[model samples]
Structure formats: structure tokens, C-alpha cells
Target: MPNAEKLRSAARLQYKRAVLWSHARRGDLVCRLMLHEHLADPYPLYEGIRAEGPVYRSRAGVQAVTAHELCGQVLRDSAFGRRNEDAGTAEPAADGPPAAADAPAGGGNASFLDGEVADHMRWRRLVAPAFRTRKIAEYRHRTEEVAHRLLDAALDRGGDFDLVTDFASPLPITVISELLGITDVDVDRFAHYGLVTGRAIDGVRSVRQATEFREAAGELDAMFTALVRRRRDEPGDDLVSDLLRPQGDERLPEQEIIGTCQLLLTAGFETTTNLVSNAVLRLLSDREQWEALVADPKLAPAVAEESLRYDPPVQYSIRVVRDTLHLGGVTLPSGTVLMLVLGAANRDPDVFPDPHRFDITRPDAGQHLAFLSGAHYCVGAPLARMEADVALSVLAERLPELRRAGRLRRRPTAALRGLLNLPVSSGR
Candidate 1:
């Protein structure tokens, strides 16, 4: 970017940071979530917001919904949509440029998740075939194989390992890499990309962070651009090549293809990484739960669902009101930005009895909105679930005595929750 544009971005970032800090100091729960101090355990803050009622009108000028029913309603409602690309104003309390809503540093909507209805459906149709049921079944066997291989390597390295780095992180990364036909995969670099992009979800907190995020995003975009060009010349059996294939003269733009690749790579593994680590963390924390899973690895699917409810990878999502609508006893005008607290809604007492308890046997666990609901519901949900199931089951069956070997360190981002380091040992 030009020096003038860089300076403007820095100024805007600082201004947003100041505004966020001020609101957080004034006890705006929504704004407070943006603070690093709250990243460790935002669930308590979520509960506080819930105490205010299902709908919380934050002092920061954004509304948050904590009720399971209400959050699901808003997600499925046609009146609520992604922030229009042409919309001039940013979401209130946005610490930096909107990460998920607007185009990222490299420009263009990075995924169908942020596109308008027509565009979203168009992109979805083109990409949906890759994630169809038949395709997912084919991927499941490979996912299981990858999980076991990761465990084998971790176990061979001695009893001790960092689960996030040694096992949980690489399983899905490898799978996604192969799916994308990335011949020379760089696990460390891709992990770094995931960290940077995930942190961007909460928006940039500093000029330094903003710079780092842009650099990472640019690098990711460049890689995909080259991959797209290569695939066009020598098409292969991969999602990119599949997309490059024409459908009766209908073709995705080159930039959009690059964006789709970026989206798939980043979104594909990040959530599963967290889901696997989070499930293992919770299960190991409670000896009974761990024993239960170890006894019957088939319960791995249940563990995955409960973990999603107990500690979702994505804690919240934002939507813009497209028309005046009354919800949760409040009349919200058009242009109102809504923060759907998926983490909080999953634990709503009215929906999940004894909401705070994490039980693998919870019959209603699958009802959680972890993947969200309606049009914006995660398209890769099946893949994530299958990957997590295989991961947790393999770990339990192979390392039944796995135990925490060191302190847990969480990723310092509120919007996307996961572990940075999960140290563990095969307690032989």
C-alpha cells in the first residue's frame, strides 16, 4: 500500500483501539471482549451479558444476543445479512478493518461467508460439490489415517509432546493440503498463517499486528494466485482444478478462485484443530470423561459435539440488520449491527439443562450453534466433525494414559478461540 494509505490505516486502527478501550472501561461487555485480558475466559463475560437479558444493547452501540432461540432466529432470518461490501460504516467496536465481513488486505471478499446473497449462493454452488456427502465419506478414511499417523510420530518422539503442534494442528493441515493438491506443504508456515488470520478475526489491535496480519494475508494470497495459475496450465484432481473447470461457460474469476483457495485453506483446518484440542483438554481435565471415552472410542462423535458446545472455536459472529425488525422484545432499526454470541447461546440454561456442565452424553449437544445456523452455517461442518471424531478417538485408543505435561496456553484472540500450546504426555 502507499505510504498515505498506510498512515490512514494506522490512524484508523489507533482510533478504534481507543474507542474500544473506553467502552470496555465503561463496562461494555461486548467491547470488553476485545481486550486481551478477557481472552483467557470470555465465557464468564458471556454469562454476565446473558444476565442482562437475552438481548444486550451494549454501551458500544452494538446489540448482542445470548438466547439460543434468538441467536438461531437471527442467523436464519433473511432480514439479517452480511455487512454489504459497499456499506460505508464499520461495525461498532470493530478494532480494525472488518476481518470477516469486508475484503481482507489482499482485497475482494475472501470467502462466500462475506458475500451478498446472490454472490454467496453462486460461490456456494461452485464449491459445494467438493464438500458433498460422498466426498466427505472419501475424506473420512484419509482423515482417520492422518490422525493415527500423527499420533505415531508424536508417540515415537517420546512420551511427551505438544498436542497442538505435534498432533492436533497437523492432522487437518495435512488433509487439507492434500485435498488442495499442495505438493510441497509447509506445516509451520501454514500454521503461522492460521494464527495470523485467526487473530485478524478479532480485528487488529495495533499497527504492528495490523502490519503482520496484512503481510500474512498478502503472502497467502500470493501463494494461491501462483497455485491458481499453475493449476490452470496443468489441471489436476484437486478443488482448485475442479473450480477451474468450466460449467457451460460459467467460470469463477481468477481473483475469486484465489480467495476461495485462501478461505478453504484457512477455514478448513483452523476449526478442526481447535475442536480436537479443546475436546482433549476438556476430557482430560475430567478423569471420568476421559475414562468414558477411552472405554468406548465410538463415543468420539459425542465428545466432538459436546466440545463444540462447551468451548466453540468461533465464539461470536456479526450480522447487519437489513430491515427494521423486532426481536427479543427490542425493536432494532435497519443498519443495526448484531453480535450473535454463539458461545453464550450454546450454554443457555433454557436450552441446555445445567448449561455449564460438559457432558459427552448430553443428548442435545448436537443442537448447539457452533457451526451456526441457516445460510451462513459452516459449509465444512461435516469435514470438521469427522476430523475431530477421528482425532479424539485415535488419541484415546492409542494414548489412553495421555496427561497434561505442561501449562496450557490459549491463542490470544477472542473471536476465534483455540490453544496455542497443549502440552501432553503418553502416561505409560
Candidate 2:
């Protein structure tokens, strides 16, 4: 019986893929996004979708929003929300056609993608304090220290090294591990889990990937569960301990604490890793941009902001309509999903003149919604910015002659835009 069910699910998924591919071949802009050939460069598709109109209805029954204003408005509107397991919105990937049966659902209690509203707000509130202004400020010095230390090791290795592995990736892993008060670090193990889980953001493509995600989630849950228990008895000065701290007379539920730690652990490192790598890749791609940063490494923050606007790590976000809302000159029924194409929105010509050009000094680069806006704005935006600022500045100052050593490779996932390997030399 179980085998029959599995076979049926796989068949359904395949059928959905066939439908998407058929529509894509017939010139469906949204369906084209799910194709591998287009994932590496999706801007053209975004522009196509935008050209059609602000709101495009995919053959898959979801709507896509590519305009900056419309995407921002949908994200900020209280009537729209993330579809979590609690809401049964996790049935499939609403961003495009249905994914594999085991594909993870939209954010909810699972990991903050699309969960129940009350639960989402409560979790956000409980975790918000740890990422408050003062708290993030406190981590800045340590972030710089980590960036410097990682660069020192990369330099010592000599010849060409992968920027993604040697520098960009490890820096955030070390920092987040410490912040979570995780002792006895397992860099290789945790990094693997983070990669698998991060790619799940794009939706699991196969049974093997689904299985791996389950194992990774289980391991992380076990680790955090133990940590929470330990913090309860002997708390430390870390985010985990702080979260476990009681609220007045009652303590946060176990699931909420676990969910908060999971969110911090995954989002804290994954997004920042891409930010640093994407920034460096963009700088190196254009010699003048690279030279400009080398000329004034102090402009690292500006470079970071520009990278977020030019080529953000996160390409798009999804929102499910909760009510019959009128937007983009169209009426969307309740339960409609909008794939807010953030990357395209960032490059919207109306909002950003000369949108395709990457200029670090663009005064309004900070206006981009790379970190999103409104109630679900990324809580780790501050930490990510600080980390990238320090990382970029340190790299420019230390290796002013940095240049690409080999062909760059981007991650296979479409939702998260980042380098899988960026081989570079110090020009030594």
C-alpha cells in the first residue's frame, strides 16, 4: 500500500512537470523559470513576465509579480501571507508548477518560510530581540575578526583557492555557530546540512533530495533540542540562551525555541555566504568596479548594498493571497500565490534608472527590497550587511589584485543565487 502511494505521488509530480514543460515550450514566462537552462540567467524571463503586465497568471494557476512597486505592495500588504503547513498551502511549490511530492511546504512553523500568522508573529517577536540594533552592533567586531582570520588562512594557502569554500562560506558558518553558542563545531557536517537545506528553498527535485532534507532537519533538531535543554539548566550569553530565557513568568514553548534557533542557524549563514560571494563575483567581473573598491576599501558597505540591488542572493519571494485583493490592475482571488520576483523588481527601470548597470555609488541602492519589506522583512538583514561589509573591505585591502583564476559556477537552485565555486588568485 505504501509503495503504491509513493508511486502515485511520483507519477503526479511527473505529470505536473510535463504540463509545465509543455507550457514553457509554448512561451509561458513563469514556466520557463523552472527550466534548468534558464535558471542561470532568469532576468530575461522576469522582464518578459513584467512586459506582459504587472501581474501574470501562470498556466500552473499562480500569479507572478515582477514590477517593483507591485511586488513591494504585495509583500507589505497584510491581506497576503506565507502559506505554511498549518494552512495546507505547502501542497506544492506555488512559485511555479508543482514540485516533487516531498518538496517542503511554504513557510510556517517548519522554518519561517510560510507558517501560520499568529505563530509566525510570536516566533518573530521571540527571536527579534536577539537581532536588535544593539545586539547586532555587539557582533560587528567579532564579524570583522572572523573575516580577517578567514582571509589570513586563504592567503597562506597560496596559489588559487575557491573564494566560496575558503573565505565566503566559512566566515558565516563560524560566526553563526558561535552566536548560537554551539560548542565543538563540526564545520564539514554543518556546512553540508546547510547546503542541502538551503537548496530546499528552491523545492526538492527528487526523492533522494527529500530524504536528505529529512535527515538534515532531524540532525539539526536533535542538536538544538539538546542545546536548549542545556541552556535551560546552565544558560550562556548566546542567542540560544537568550531565547530560552523566560518571558515574565512563563517560558517560550519548546517548538518555538527550536524553530527560532533553526531559522537563525540556516538563514544567518546561507544568505550572507551568497552576499559576500555575489559581491566579490560582481566586483571581479567588472575591472573598474574592482579597482574602485581597491581604491577605497572603505566603500565596502556601498559595494554590499549595490550587490544586493544588482544581483541579490535571494532572487524572489512567494506570497499567498488571503483575501480577494485588487492589485496591479487585476483582481486576484483568495488563495492565489504571487511569486514576487525580487531580482527583477530590484532592476525595475521605473524605480531604478539604468537598472542593469552595477554602480557601487548609486545613492539609492539602499532602497532595493533585497532584504524584503514589511512584517516579514528578514530579521538578519543587519547581521548580513555587517558581515558582508567587513568581508568585502578586508578582501579589497588585503588582496587588491584579486582576480578570477578559473570559470565561476553558480548554485543549481534557482531561488538562491550564489556561486558554487569561485576560483580566484591574489595576483601574487
Candidate 3:
């Protein structure tokens, strides 16, 4: 970017941070979430926002909804949509660097997840087949194998191991890499990419972080571009090849294909990694739950669902009012941005009784909106669930004696809730 443009961007970021900090200091729960200090435990603040009623308007003007019903309604309502170019709400700078200047040719760095209804549906349709039930089943065995292999290595190392680094992180990375036909796998680099991009969701905290995000994004894009080109020449049994397949009349543009690959790699890797780590952390924290899972590994799926509901990897989502509408006793004008606190919604007492309690046996655990709802629901949900299930089941069977080896370290991001380091031991 030109010096002038960079200066403007930096100024906008500084101004936004100042406003958020001001509101945070003035006790705006929503704004407080943006502060690093609250990263470790934002649930209390979520409850604080809930105390202000279902729809809590922050001093910053963004409305937050913690009610499960309201969050679900907004997610399913066509009147509320993803942010567009003209939307009044600016993308949080901390969320990541601006896409416009850094975006590659074609459609730039815009995600189809953020596109308008028609375009979003079009892209979703094109890629939905890869993550369908049948495809996920096909990948299940591979996921199980990878999970066991990871645990085997961890066990061989003996003593204590950082679960996040040793198993949780790499399992999904390997699975997603194979799914994408990335043969020259660099596990550490990909994990770094996942970390950089995942944290980007919360926005860049400083000029240094912004620079790292840009570099990671650029590297990821270049890597996918090369993969797409290679797959086009020598198609294989992988997602990229499947996307590159000739779809008579409907075909994704080359840029969209690359973007989709990048999305799948980071989202798929990060979400599953966090899900496994969070589930294990909670289970081990409550020995009864851990013992139950160890006693009956079949409960792994339930464990996964409960983990998603109790402590989802993704904590929140943002939507813009596409049309004037009355919601939660408040009338929101078009262009108004609303924050849907998914974590808080999942723990809504009305939806999940004893909401804060981590119970794997909660029958309605599947009702949570962790994967969101409506058109923008995560397409990778099936794969994530399968990976988590396999991961937890394998760990339970092999390391039933597993226990925390050290204090957990959380990723310093509000939008995404995950552990940076989860140390564990076989406890034999």
C-alpha cells in the first residue's frame, strides 16, 4: 500500500482502538471483550451484557444479543446479513489487516461467507459436496488413524506433552492437509498459519501483529495458488481437485477456488484443534466427566457436542441489519451492526438448563449455535465433529490416565476461544 493509504489505515486503527478502550473503561461489556485482559474469561462479561437484557446496546453503538432465541432468530433472518462494502460497521482492525489493498487479483480477499445471499449460496453449493455426510464418513477412518498416530508419538515422548502442540493441533492440520492434497506438508508452518489467521479473527492488536497477519495471509494465498495450479494439471482425490472438477455451467473462479482452499485449511485446522483441546481441558478439570468418557469411549460424540455447546471454539459472530427490524424490544435501523454472542447464547439457561455446567450427557447439546445457523452455517461442521469425535475417542482409549501437566495458556483473542498451549501427561 502507498504511504498515504498506510497512514490513513493506521490512523483509523488507532482511532478505533481508542474508542473501544474508552468504552471498555466506561464499563461497556461488549467493548471490554475487545481488551486483552478479558480474553481469558469473557463469559462473566457475556453475563453482564445479558444482565442489560437480551439486546444490550454498547456505547460504541453496536447491539449485542445473548439470548439463544434472539441470536438464532437473527442468524436465520434474511433481514440481517453479513457485512458488505457499504455497511456502516467497519471490519475490526484487530480482526485482521484490510483486505482491499492486500487482496490478490479477481475478487480480492473477500470471503464468500461474507458475500451477499445469492453469491454466498452459489459458492456454498459448489463446495458443499466435499463436506457432505458421505464424504465425512470416508474421512473418518483417516482421522482416527491420524489421531492415534499423534497419541502414539506423544506417548513415546513420555513424561509430559503439550497436547495442543503434540496432538490437538497437528491432528486437524494433517487431516486437512491430506484432504486438500497438500503432499509437501510442513506441519509447523501450517500450525503457525492457523495461529496467525485464527487470531486475526479478533483483529490485529498492533502494527507488528498486522504485519505478521499480512505475511501469513500472503504466504497462505501463494501456497494455495500453487496448489490450485498443480491440481488443475494433475487432478487427484482431494477437495481442491473436487472443486476444480468441471461443473458444466457452474464453476468457481480461480481466485475463489484458492480462497476456498485457504479458508478450509485455516478454519478446519483451527476449529477442530480448539474443540479437542477445550473438551479435554473441561473433561479433565472435572474428573467425573473424564472418567465417564474413559469408561465409555462411545460417549466421545456426546463429549464433542457438549464441548461445542459449553465452550465453543468460535465465541461470537457479527451481522449487519439489511432491513429495518424490531428485535429484542428494540428497533434497529438498516446498516446497524449486531454482535451475536454465540458462547453466551449456547449457555442460555432457557436453552440449556444448568448452562454453565459441562455435562456431556446434555440431550440438547446439539441445539447450540456454535456452527451458527441459516445460510451461513459452517459447511465444515461434519468434518470438525468427526475429527473431534475420533480425537477424543482415541485419546480416551489410549490414555485414560491423561491429566493436565501444567497451567493452560489461552490464545489472546476474543473472537476465537482456544488454548495456545495445553500441557498433558499420561499419568501412568
Could you tell me which residue pairs clash in candidate 2? 107-113, 107-114, 107-115, 108-114, 108-115
Best by lDDT: 1
Cα lDDT tens digits, model 1, 1-428, are 68888788788878877887888888888878866658777889999999998788876567889999999998888888777445533222246323342333233435676676778788888888888889989999998888788778887888899999988899999999988888788999999988887777777666667667767877887888899999999999999999899877678998888878888888899999999999999988999999999999999999999999999998888887888989999999988878888899999999999999999999999999999888877888988988898898888889899899899999988778899999998996
lDDT of 2 by residue, 164-243 (tens): 99888888888889999999877778768767866776655555665676678778888888998998899999988887
Please give the lDDT score for candidate 1. 0.83
Note the Cα lDDT for every prediction shown: 0.83, 0.78, 0.82
Comparing 2 with 3 on TM-score, the higher-scoring candidate is 3
Q: Candidate 3: worst 10 consecutive residues by lDDT?
A: 97-106
User: Which digits, one per residue and each the tens of the lDDT, describe model 3 over residues 59-146?
Assistant: 7567889999999998898888776347322223442222211122112355566576789898888888988999999999988888
Indicate the TM-score of model 1: 0.94
Instruction: List candidate 1 stretches off by more than 4 Å.
Output: 1-11, 88-110
Model 1 weakest lDDT span, ten residues long = 89-98
